[model samples]
Target: MNFLKSTYGAMMLVGLLAVSCNRDEDMQQGTDTEEEQAVETSSEGEDASDDALEMAYQGEHQLSVSGGRVKNTLCATVTNDKVNKIITIDFGDGCVGPYGRERKGKIFIAYSSEVGDSIANRIITFGDFFVNNKGVTGTIELRDVSINADGNLQSTKRLKDLTITFPNGQKVVYNGSRTREWLAGAGDDDPTNNKYKITGTVTGESTTGRSFTQEIVEPIIADWSCAAQGNFARVSGVVEMTKLNGYSVRKRTVYYGDGECDNVITITTFRRTYTITVDN
Candidate 1:
């Protein structure tokens, strides 16, 4: 009986050792599996993060405008990446007017979001106009323009100030509510009997207290009988002009041309009036 008891105890001891060994092996395997899974998960997360960062570094964009008396449309494509970025704008054909009379200019875009959202500034430079052998160049500084989350322009804000420099080196500055109108065919109408009017005012260092009114007309003759008598036909008219805070002035002129009664000549005249106030 003593021998049987000792043998039974020994067998029980062996069984417990076997069970412990199995349990330890299982625990080690479980730990290794968990660590492997963690590494795989971390790698996947890093890949996803890299993909998101790459996407954020690149973007595509466009801009367009329509409506108003002037049918003007402008579009731009911008490609931004970490290394380099490029932007190209297309101010559609006929954007300004007829052939030779077009609105061809370069628009510069600069922005900074680091400033407060209440104020966004921009500088616009106009190179020249295509027609009239004249150019319209200016710099407009705008503030408080709206933008979207991706740094895209939403709408134009109020004009803080404006500087216009004509081709003749004439400069004008103004601070007021100014809006742009895109006339479809502003100065390209028929020259025989077409008449048009353009009125505006400028205020700044050169034209602080000045305003102007201009009228454009096609060919017209007041004395046709003179042409039939082998004489020149003459056109006479009075142009009404005004200055800022000043009375209107009527300027009269006569235009003559040598022509026959049977044949009529078409002529177009572009007139502009300036009311300037010199600084003391």
Candidate 2:
């Protein structure tokens, strides 16, 4: 599948998508000091898990009961139980994958029913999974998978207590539901040209003990072709992240560029607007 070519780049860009305020000028002095790092880690954790799941899904058919395997940068060994509808991707010990990222442990993909079934679900769970040494635990459920009126594949994704524990021992908990619709290239077998329209709301608590709700005010357009060209996968979208504090709220909005493939994004908070140049 074309995902084999685009998955690496897309996952690399996911690292950049995580907002990082490491730069001193990005925010006021000592304003939510830990917020930037916390958000960055959380976002990275979420996307890493996503990247792994996508990989497993694309190569699922390659696995068999006789110790079948799928060849990829991660050097993972794939196995499955057709009777039980479970697919397992195991990255034994530690393996350096694309961009020198090391992953260890296993990912479990369980199907509620046949993949072609009208009403089926994909449940993803982990077994001591660690990406870049950060422990990731949680269940990601993709339920009600079906084709929409527009001839696009659509699904409802529920994240239940998705937690990421950083190497520093700090942890972040994330929960949310997202609606994903394959806006383009669903009929085609080339995943590199695939595009998706994602709308969702995520609630999470950062390592700094700050609680935030992130809503996608504008539908996110994810284009894999852009990533195939070594660019950001997210072409356009607007996300509002509001931190709740007693009766007050602090809002920070992120704006992906206007259908551009460049690694540039604008982050706006009540304090100021910061233009960030992401590293590809």
Candidate 3:
């Protein structure tokens, strides 16, 4: 009887041990299966995300070049994940004039992901063109144009660069950046209720062994009392000059255009008056 009882106890212990081992193995297998499932789900999600991103930028949009010396009614398309864009100039019927005829040149722009922003480090390839005494040869990178969150136009290209070309074969390069801040209605005694100010600087180098640094500090004052009648009472309190370079002195002028109400001012030597109808 004692031997039988001992045998029975041993069998019970063995059975318990077997059950525990089996449970542990089942738990481990379950954990491994869950881990694999999670990995598969994550991989699928990443693939879907990549596919969506790829599809989001595939399309074409027409681009037109107007204003300035660009008289041609050109059109272009944005395609290939927005990485490649091509612009073609039609020069339009002869009625479009000579400036349009000159725009028959080709332009290609390519974007790289390595570059942080589309405006920075972009490769803008320009083709042959004859404008005034300037002749195009090789493709040079277009730099210094900044597109901020607000889509304001800010560039470091000086007035001299806008008009002058290097006598040497080399091209002038703009390498610096600028930020402009405008403040309106800061002073209580200010007469112009739409009083505002702008401050920024531009620094760049020339291939002709010359360097340039310019500082801009200016206030834009506009009287909106006359604004209702398509007129503006304006004054500019700003001074701009290049410390070491020979350039024209920045002077103040009265605002006359209909589109001159914004802080994003376009300083031009030409003076023109336009009837402005203010919107509520």
lDDT ranking from best to worst? 2, 3, 1
Cand. 1 Cα-lDDT: 0.29
Cα lDDT, model 3, residue 34: 35
Per-residue lDDT of candidate 3, residues 1-280 (tens digit): 9999999999999999999988656544433233222222211111111111111111111221121123212222222323343332222221221112122233344444422242433343434432222332333333465654555533332222221122334343333333322133322222123332233454444443334443445442333333323332332333232332222333322222343533222232222222222111
lDDT score for residue 191 of model 1: 17
- 210 in model 3: Cα distance from truth in Å? 2.1
lDDT of each: 0.29, 0.68, 0.31
Flag regions of model 3 displaced more than 4 Å.
Answer: 1-72, 75-101, 111-123, 129-172, 179-199, 206-208, 219-239, 245-280
Among all windows of 10 consecutive residues in model 3, the one with the lowest summed lDDT is 51-60
Query: Which of the two, 1 or 3, has more TM-score?
Result: 3
Please provide, for model 2 over 102-184, each residue's C-alpha lDDT reduced to its tens digit, 9 standing for 90 to 100: 77888888988753343478888899988767787898888878878977789987888888887878887889898988787
| Local lDDT at 245 for model 3 | 27
Best candidate according to lDDT: 2
What candidate 1 gets wrong by more than 4 Å, as runs, is 1-101, 113-120, 129-134, 146-173, 178-245, 248-280
User: For model 2, what is the error of residue 91's alpha carbon versus the real structure, in angstroms, after optimal superposition?
Assistant: 2.4
